[model samples]
Target: MQEIFSAILGDQLGPFGPLILMGTLGAVLILFTLPVLLKKKQDPLDRLRDQIKTSKDVANGKAPARLRYDNQKGARLEKYSAFLEPQDEEEYSAAQLKMIQAGYRSKNAVRMFHFAQFAMGLGALALGLIYALLKSAQQDMSPKSLVLTVLLPGVIGYMAPKYWVTRRIEARKEEIVNGFPDSLDLMLVCVEAGQSLDQAIIRVAVEIRAGFPALADEYEIVSHEIKAGKDKSVVLKDMAERCGVPDVASFVTVLIQSQQFGTSIADALRIYAAEMRDKRVMRAEEAANKLPTKMTLATMMLTVPPLLIILIGPSVYDIYTLLNETNF
Candidate 1:
């Protein structure tokens, strides 16, 4: 009965082997091709929306008509606008929407990044399957072995992109955080110069371009949204949330409160900027203090072992020589 069953299974898989191979290849091809197809379908809608938005902005005196129409020589502004849409729109507040617009150049790039991850996973699985088949051709292949060899690589490949995205987000957030204090200082200067809060934010965004490009980009978005007639408090709050940083959120909260109570914007900015700088300094000091502790394990593993090897080596070698000379 077992032999009969085995024979039946072998016969079924034999004729279908070529078909299975073809299907697997087709699946991988589709895995790569589908994203491109979907992006093509989606691009027109994105472009139309951006054009409408730009037109509205120009009509409202939010952005100059020239700014909307002026393209770098040979540049496709429509394509650029479509590419600049925010990723994870639902996750952003109005302020955050501005920041995302300013900071990330391509929303489609984000989507393509995710798609590339999936393609890599599929490719890894295909490679594993190919390797397994080739190896099996030279030896016996068990079901368990086949599953491990093929599936492991696929799973690892699939996870790589997710891990990469998470790391990138963290690194970007840190970059923004590191630049925040300087941006705040610039805002304070603008406020002191008699600019209104919104105007100050725009100026800071412009002024900090050379030094803190990421924060400048975020500020540019805030300026754009304000120009579009969004409520000031709402935009600030949204910006804080989108930034996903405690310091920026605290600063935004201060701005919102100051705006609500008609407090001095310059004073608020000055105080917050000082506090941020102090916190940054303390953080650096704390990190410096921890370095000795961090080095302790390495010191023991590296320094102590080398010292021991130097101190004990001659005695051990002499004993070995003496023992050898005396015979076993």
Candidate 2:
């Protein structure tokens, strides 16, 4: 038993063993502590509840009307509120701005994305370091080579998250765009069925919830804005701006103008939906036309080099054999 314990201790405390133990402990500590720290810092509901309490106190003349929360999250909330503030200098409450900003937006998910990026970068750095250490310990490596090996992986890791984020954003935008015409068609049907514009938006939002959650989410934001007493035009415009899609923006502008001019909303929506469908058809045809070009490029990349190698290799070997025979 004594010998066994001594062997175990010797293995653990061998050369560079302490370093391994320290690294493991540090990693475990970070994993255990980071969530606790982030959770403590990120409880928005607590801040919101505090804000409500402060508002009640101020309204009852029990406390001075001054800002209470002073964290980064609070500051971000304030900035978002300022951005959402109506330009007419009306007595618009900050609550409305907060609601608008929070409506259908995943604050934690955005933060988690950034966190994921950081973790990826750190992982890459660790991988690079491990590679460098292993190479240096196992083989005679120069300092420059070690540095290059270590730094290259870290750099790749840093850029990977940015690339992933960009791809996700593009994919989400495409999904929203693809779902727009259908949502518009549903709205048109609802309007023709005698629902008001707001009701139509709500009905369409509900209808699209299963198939296109992203579009449904945007419409839900519009519904929230309307419920918050924002004007229909403003809500629609905000939806367009938030979506950042040209077709949706144009549709919103057209709807606003039609409403202002007493034009038929259903007719305008139907026309827009028809136009979008036509555009989608054109895009499909364009993609189909490009398929041959894409295929040609792919074939050149994947097939041509191998074909050249196979065709040239036997001839080159034959020529070499003939030249050797002549020399003999």
Candidate 3:
């Protein structure tokens, strides 16, 4: 293979053909094998054991192991977090909020996100530089092209993490929006059925997991926080912020006000759930109303040109044939 590579690229690559080929093969081999080697191995029963332990801990009114593990991981990350996080307090908080809203609530979430951005950008820059070098060696590459080749990938890589987080946040918001009304209805039922607000929240979280895991997960967090003896208002408010949904914010306000002004919780849930159902209906109708306008361009692009050709093609062909006859 070395001889074959050298013979094939002896002129272009000169004496370095085998070396380049060997390096490429090594890189490819590492690319294929590194992930498998780096992946942490877990026993098949590990998840079951963790689940059983967590259930027992929760039943015994103790903090779950998962939370402790997360805290420990966060502490470990903190030691090297200087370069892994934004220096600006506001930016750090914003990034953390974004991460939470995107369904990542680990304390190391911000650090990991920033690290991903740095790693991706650096890797892309290196790859671009390697490509530029190779191309320059293989053939002439204009300076503008070279600069673009070296910089474009880095810019895109630097922005990719943010782009992904933004998309995740949007997708989570949509899920929460779509599933929230049902959750509200269920919560209302739970409240009406004589369960306390906390139990109702936990019940809703459990029930809603199949259809809308994101909203369910948020409810579960709210339930856990409430169980942990956090101020209910603060917990609700934090949930609202983490969700970043207006409906959720309004729901939180309603609960807070109901508690403050001595209004009935069941009544508030009933009213809010009705409103949410109505809003869901309205949203569906709005989407339906906009469908034709959204489809108009597609309709024209797909249907009109072929239709015109079908209608006018014979006439145009006849005219062309007549012109040719006249010219001849």
By lDDT, the best candidate is: 3
User: In candidate 1, residue 233 scores what lDDT?
Assistant: 84
In the range 37-145, model 3's lDDT, one tens digit per residue, is: 6455568799889989888889999954454334766675565576678889999999899999998887789988887887798688768767866876687666687
Residues 198-258, model 2: lDDT tens digits: 8998999899899888788888888988999999999988887666678888998999999
Ten contiguous residues minimizing lDDT sum, candidate 2: 95-104
RMSD of 2: 9.3
**What TM-scores do the predictions have?**
0.69, 0.64, 0.77
Evaluate model 2: give its lDDT.
0.72
Off by over 4 Å in 2: 1-104, 108-116, 300-328
- What pairs collide in candidate 1? none
Residue lDDT tens for model 1, 1-328: 4455446445333333344456567877986775455453457889999899998998888975354443342243234333333445674344234334334444344444445566688889888887876666566666687778888998999888667666755766887888898888888887898888788888888887887676777788788999999998888887776677889889989988888898888889899999999998998999999999999999899999889899999999999999999996
* Residue 88 error, candidate 3, Å: 2.6
Which stretches in model 1 have alpha-carbon errors above 4 Å? 1-114, 139-142, 324-328
Q: Cα deviation in Å at residue 92, candidate 2? A: 22
Per-candidate alpha-carbon RMSD to the true structure: 8.2, 9.3, 10.2
